[model samples]
Target: MDGVRFGEMQTSELVVSSRANARVKQLRAAFQGHARLSGGMVAIEGDHLLEEAWRSGMVLKTVFVSERRTVPGIVPRGVEVVRLTEEVFGSVVETQSPQGVAALMVPPVRVLADLFEGAGAALILIAAGVQDPGNLGTLVRSAEAFGANGVLTTPGTVSAWNQKALRASVGSLFRVPVVGVTASEVAELEGRGVRLIAAVGAEDSGVVAAREMDFTAVCAVMIGNEGSGLAAEWMEMCDARVTIPCPGPVESLNAAVAGSLLLYEASRQRAVSKVSGS
Candidate 1:
C-alpha cells in the first residue's frame, strides 16, 4: 500500500491477539522507546515508513500486519511477517488510528567517514541541543530534502528516531544517515576544514544574512535548542554566525524552521555554483 492501510490486505496466518505475547510485548516496548527491550530495533508504523524502510534496504526484524491485512508488496521476500489482531495492534502502535501495519528495523551503524564519502562537498546539519523530537525529525527531513550529506546530533539533542519525529519526517529517517557525536568530536570538524556556522537570532550583531553567506564550501550549519538558541561554547567554535532576515515582526523562528531555511539557502547557492561552473 502507498499510504496508511486499514485492513487492506488479507492474511491467512493466525492473528496474534494476546497483548502479553513475547513479540507483542517487545513491539510495545519499542513503541515506548525502550531500546534495551526492543534490542535496539526501531519500531515504525504506517505504510509510508514500511515503504521507505524497504526502499532504503533496512534490515527488517519483523513486519507486523493487522489481522486480515496481508504483507505489503513493498516488503521483501524472506522477511518475517506477523499478523496481529486489530485490538492488539492498536494497543502497541502510538497512533490513535493504527494503519494496520508496522515494522521493526535495525538502525544502521554509521561512522564519521560515512558522512564524507559522497563525491559532492559535505553539507551536514548539526543539531546542537534541540530537545523536540518533531523538530529533530524535521531537521533530518530538511537535510535530505535540501541535499545535505548527513545530519549530526550532539550529545544533548533528542533522538533523531523519536516516534513523533519519525512521523513528522514522513519517512526521511530511513534514507538519511544520522550520527550522534560528542562535543570533542564536533570540534574535530574544524580541524578538517569544515566551517561551522552557528545560526543565531535576528537581532544578533555581526551576523551575516543567510542569503549573503556562501554555503558552497564544506560546512555544517548548527541549530540550537528551542529556548536558549546556541550556547556560548558552540558560538565560539563557529567560524561565522548567520541570521535569517525576517522583515515581519518576529523574534525568532522555530529550530526546525531556521535550520530548514538555512539549508534551503545553502542548496540555492550550491545549485547556482554548479550551474555557473564556479
Candidate 2:
C-alpha cells in the first residue's frame, strides 16, 4: 500500500467528488478572493505553506490533500482531512506544480495594538501603491527578516491575499499582519505615538539617514508607488520625509529595494542601540 489506502483510515474521512462540490467551490472561491473566510479563517495552499502555518500555531480547520500525492506530514489530531482528485486539486491550487496539500486556517486576529506589545522601539513598513505582487511579497519578507513591527498598505495597493503576493511572500504574509486601509488611517498609528517617516524623491538631505535614526523610538517608514512616488497630501502627514542618499546617477530605487534598505537600517540601529544601552 502507498499509505494512501483510505480503507485503513477512519470512516469519517471525506472523499470529495465533482469539482462542483460545495467544498470544492468554496476552496476555489478562496483562491479567487471571492470567499473571505468568516471568523478570521484564511485559505493557504501547498504543503510548504501548510507546514509554515502549522509551525506558526494557526488553527487548522481542514486539510485538503490530493489522492495521488503522498500524505503530508503529521497534522493536528482532530483536524478535518479531505481527499481530492488530482485534477480537482490542481484547479484550486495557484502554482503549476500543486503541492497536493492545502489548508483552511484561522489567522490570529491581530490589530495595530497587537504589534506594539513588546518593549523597546516599534518598526513599521508603510507601502502606498505597490502594484506588483512580487514587490509586496519581497517587502514583507524583508520586513520580517529586518524586524519590522508590521506592514500597512494603502487603499490603492494590491490585495495582500492575492495568490501571487501570498506565493511570493513565502509565508511572511502569514507571519506578519498585513493590513490594508487608507493613507489617513496611517496617521492614527502616529496619534498612538508612532513617528511617521515618509520617503520622498525630492529631498536632497535624506530624512535622518536610516542609520542615523533613533530606532529606540516607535517609528513607521512610509514607501510609496513605483511610478508617481508619494502623493503630496500623504507626504505632508509624515512627521518627517526622508530619502535614501544615493551617490550613483540612478534617479531612484525600486519600491521594494528602497523599503528593504530602510527596514534593514532600522534593524541595524535597534541592534546597536541594544548593545550600547542608549
* Best candidate, TM-score: 1
For candidate 2, lDDT tens digit of each residue in 153-218? 887888877778877888888788777767667878778798888876555554565555565688
Any runs in candidate 1 off by more than 4 Å, and if so which? 1-12
Q: Show where candidate 2 strays beyond 4 Å.
A: 1-15, 36-41, 202-208
Worst 10 residues of 1 by lDDT: 1-10
- Per-candidate TM vs. native? 0.93, 0.87
TM-score of 2: 0.87
Q: Measured by C-alpha RMSD in angstroms, how accurate is candidate 2? A: 3.9
Q: On residues 1-278, what C-alpha lDDT tens digit does candidate 1 reach at each position?
A: 21223243333346777788777888888888999999888999999888988888889878899875767897876666778888889889998878899988898887777889868889989999999999999999999999998999988898877899899888888878889998889999988779999999875567999988989999999999899999888988999999999999899999999999999999999999999995
In candidate 1, which residue pairs clash? 9-69, 9-70
